[model samples]
Target: MQGEEQWFSRTPGVEARQKIELDMVNSLLTSVAFASDPSRQLALEIIAEQFEQPATIRTHPTPRAQLIEIVRTYARNPDGLRVLVDVVASFDPQSFGTVRLRQLFDEWQAAPSFTDDDWSAFRSALGDVVLPQLTELFHLATRNRRHRPPAHCKTAWHYFVHLTDLNAGADSVPPYMIFLERVAPLLPSSTGQELRMRNHRLASELGLITAVNEIHLHERESLPPQHHTAYLVIQLESDGIDPERYTLSHWYQWDADGWHPERGEDRTVSILEIENEVERLVFDMETNWVEAVETVTLEFILPWELINAPVDWWRKESHSSRPTPLTMDYPVVVRSLERLRTHRWHRAWHVRWQRLNTDPTSVLPYWSKPAGKNYHTLLETDLKSDLRYACLVLSEPPLPDSSGRTEIETALRAGLPVIIWHRRDCGSPDFREAVQQMLAGETLAQLPILARKLRGEALRLDLADRESHIGRHLTMLWDDPERQPEVSRSYGTPEEGIR
Candidate 1:
C-alpha cells in the first residue's frame, strides 16, 4: 500500500487491449430474454478489463482459476485491491473477495502492525466506505485481545483519533458518540470522557441542552439502506390542556458536511424558535437521542454558531433555513442593587413602574430578561417576544421578595440601572429629593400644604382640562416678573394662605 506510489507512476503495456462501450456492455447484461452463452463469456472478460492492467488475461483451464489469477494479480496494488473488492461486493455480498477483505480487517484489528506513512494510501484505498464502516471498526476495537494501550494498535489508534476529529465541532450529530457509548466500558476512563465531551459540546449547541421528559424512537419499517431514516417520538415541556403531546418526527443524515436536515424529512426548526416556542411544532426533535437536555433559553446556541465561525446563526438568524434575524424586544432596564434587599425593592418598583408606564416604548425597553425567567410567561412565545410589566403598590417596609432582590442584584452586575422611586410611607423622601429645587430658588416643593392643595385641584379637573390647571399652578408657584409680588399673590389664594 505504501510503495504503490512508485509503480502507479509508470505506464504498463496495452498491446492486446480491445475498445469496449460500457453502454453496450450494460445492454448485454440487461437483455435477459436474449441471454446466451457468448454474452456470459463477454461479461466475465469485461469484468477482467476493470483489473487487468497489462491487457493479458492468463489462460486457465478453469474459469474459477482464471478469476483467482486476476485477484492474485490485483492484490499486489492496494488501489486495485480496494476497487476490485468493491466490484466483487456489487456482484455478490458473500463473494470470496469480500470475505477475504473482512478477514484482513479482522486480522488487523485483532493485532495490528505499525508502519511508516501512517497508512495514508490504505486509508485512501478505503475511501468513503471507511465512514459507514466506522461502527463496525469501533466494535472490532472493543475486542482487544492484546494487553496494551489502544494507541499501540493501528485500528484503535487511527479510529480513536478519527472518531474524535469527526465529532469535534460538527454541527450535525455524528455517529461517533454512538460508537463511543457502545465501547465506553472497554476504553480508558480519560479517553472515554474526552470523546463524550466532544460529542456533548456539539449536542448542547442545537438547543438539545434540555432535560428529556420522555422520548420514543421506534423504527416502523426498514427502508432502503441509502435512505438511512429513523422516527423519533419526543415529549418536550408542553403547556396545554391535554397530557398527550406529540412532536414531529426528526430524520437526520450525517455526511462529510455537518448534520443536514433531510429536506422534507427534517422539519426546519430554529434555535430561536425552540427557546421561545418550546411547546411549538418546530423544536429540537433530536432531544430523543442527544444527551443532557436542559431548559431551553434564547441564549442557548447551535453548533454552527460556536466560536470562530464564519457566521453565527445563534446570534443573527432564526435557523439555517430561515435567515431572518431574531429581533428581540426592547430591554427592561433595572438598577444595580448594593444590598440583597434591593432586588426585592427593585422588583416592587418594577411592578409599579411598568403598570404606570403602560405605553409600549417604556414597557418594552432596549434590553430584557432571558427566555426562561420569573418574568417570561410566554413559554411558547417567539424568542423575539417579551414579557409585560407588573406593578407593586406597597405602603411600607418589606418592599419586594427574595427573587426580586436577586433580580436587582443581577441587573446591577450586568451594568443596567434600575430606577427606584422610593417615597417613604410618611411621604418624607417625596420632598427630600426636591432640595435641589430649593437650591435653585424653586423653594416651594417643601411646602406640603401648597403641594396638596395644588394636587387636589388638578385631580378635580377633567383629563382634557388638566393642562390649563397645570399652567395656572405653574403661574402661582413663582410670581410673574412683569407684575408686582402683591398683585400675583392676590390673584392666587390657596385656602386663604397658599394655592
Candidate 2:
C-alpha cells in the first residue's frame, strides 16, 4: 500500500485519470438538470452512432430514463465513457442561455493535487471555517447519541471522520478533499473547493505541481447528503357524524427514513379552533425538530371538505404585534386524507408520481371547466386516458355546490398527484395564468417552493383585499405517494369490507 506522501503524488497513472473522467461523467449525467434537458436525447443518439460497433440502445419514454439507459450502456467502456465526458462538457442550454457544464468540467480538471504544504493550508482553512461552528457541528453529528464519537475524537479531524468517514470505520481520518467537501456547507467561510483551488495557485508560485489529478474513491463512500429541512405532518380526521369537529394526529419526518409517530393525546377540536391548535403544533415542531433541522415544511393532511381551508394564511401568535402567515416561515402543502385511507388509487398515485419526476412536461395539468352534473365522469375519463394527466386545475371552488369538489375527487380517484385551484375564484383568467406560470417548468417537485413564493406575495397585500388575489387563495394538493406518514390501519374509514 502507498504511504500518505505517495497518495498525494503529482504524477498519476492513466487508470487514475480514467477514474476521474468516469466520476465526472456520472456526476454530470445523473444531475436532474442534465437528465431532463431536451437536447440530451439527440446528443446521446448521435454519440451512440459514432461508435465503431453498433450500440443498440433501448427506447425509453422520458429523457431522464433515456439518459439513465445511456449511462448504463457506456459507463464501463473506456472509449464510450470518454466520448460522454467530452459531449457533456460542451452542453449549452438554448432556452436558459446557461453554460455551466463546460465551466464545471474545466474546474474539475483545473483543480490541483494536494502537496504537504497545500494540505496544511487546506486544513488551516477548514479550521477557520469549521472551528467556530465546532460545537454546533458536534451536536448535529451526535444527534442520534448511539452514533456519538468516542472520547478520543477530540480534534476537528476526528470529529469529521465520525461525521463523513462512513466505510473507513469509526476512527480513520478522511482525505483533505473529503474533509473540505463534508464541511463546505459549514457556517460563515470560504467554500471547500474554492479553498483547494486557491491553495493550488499559491503552491504553483513556489514551483510545486499542486493540481488534483487522481480521483479518490473514498469521496464516493462519504455520508449521504444532509437533509436540512424536516417535515411536520398534521393529519386532520373529521368526526364521521359532525362536519365541524376533527381528531388531530401529527407526525415528524426527519428525512427519507419515513415518518415517526409522535406520542400525543387524542385531541379533538371544532373547525373554528383548528387554527389555534395548528399554531400549538407548529410550536411543538420548533421546540422539537426545527433547531436541529434548519427549516420545517408543514404538510397538512385534510379531508375533502377542509382541503381548501386557508391553512397557509392562519397566523401564528408570535411576540410581534403583526405576525405573518405560516406560509412566510414554512413551505405549506396539503395532502388528501381521503386518498391516504384508500389503497385502490395508490398504484396510480405511485405510477403518476414516477411519471411526474421522469417526464414532467408530459404530465400537464387537466384544466376543468364548469359542466353538467356528470362532469366528474368526463374528468375521470380525461385523467385516465393515455395522456396520463398527473395534475388537476379546478374551474371553481370545490365546495359542495361548485364543481371543484367533484373535480378534486375525480383527480384523486384517478391518482393525480397534484391539484391546484384558487379557493374562491377558479373561474378567473388571472388564476389560469398563475397556474400556467407555475407549471411552465419541467420540475413538478418544486411546486411547494413556488407555492410558498405565491403565498408570500399574498401576505404582502392588505388583509381585507388579500382574498381578492389568487395568491392568497392558492391551494395545492402536492401529495407524494413515497413520503407518506405512518397512520393507524383502523384510524380512518377503511374500504367497505376490510374491517
Best of the candidates, TM-score: 2
Once fitted onto the true fold, the runs of candidate 1 whose alpha carbons sit more than 4 angstroms away are 1-44, 48-55, 61-68, 94-113, 116-499
Candidate 1, residue 487: lDDT: 14
lDDT (Cα atoms) of all candidates against the true structure: 0.30, 0.63
TM-score of each: 0.21, 0.54
Candidate 2 residue pairs that clash = 112-211, 112-212, 113-210, 113-211, 113-212, 398-405
TM-score of 1: 0.21
Q: After superposition, how far is residue 270 of candidate 2 from its true place, in Å?
A: 2.3
lDDT of 2 by residue, 258-291 (tens): 3333434446899888988999988866765523
Cα deviation of 472, candidate 1, in Å = 73
- Best candidate per lDDT, number? 2
Compute the lDDT of residue 428 as modeled in candidate 1: 34
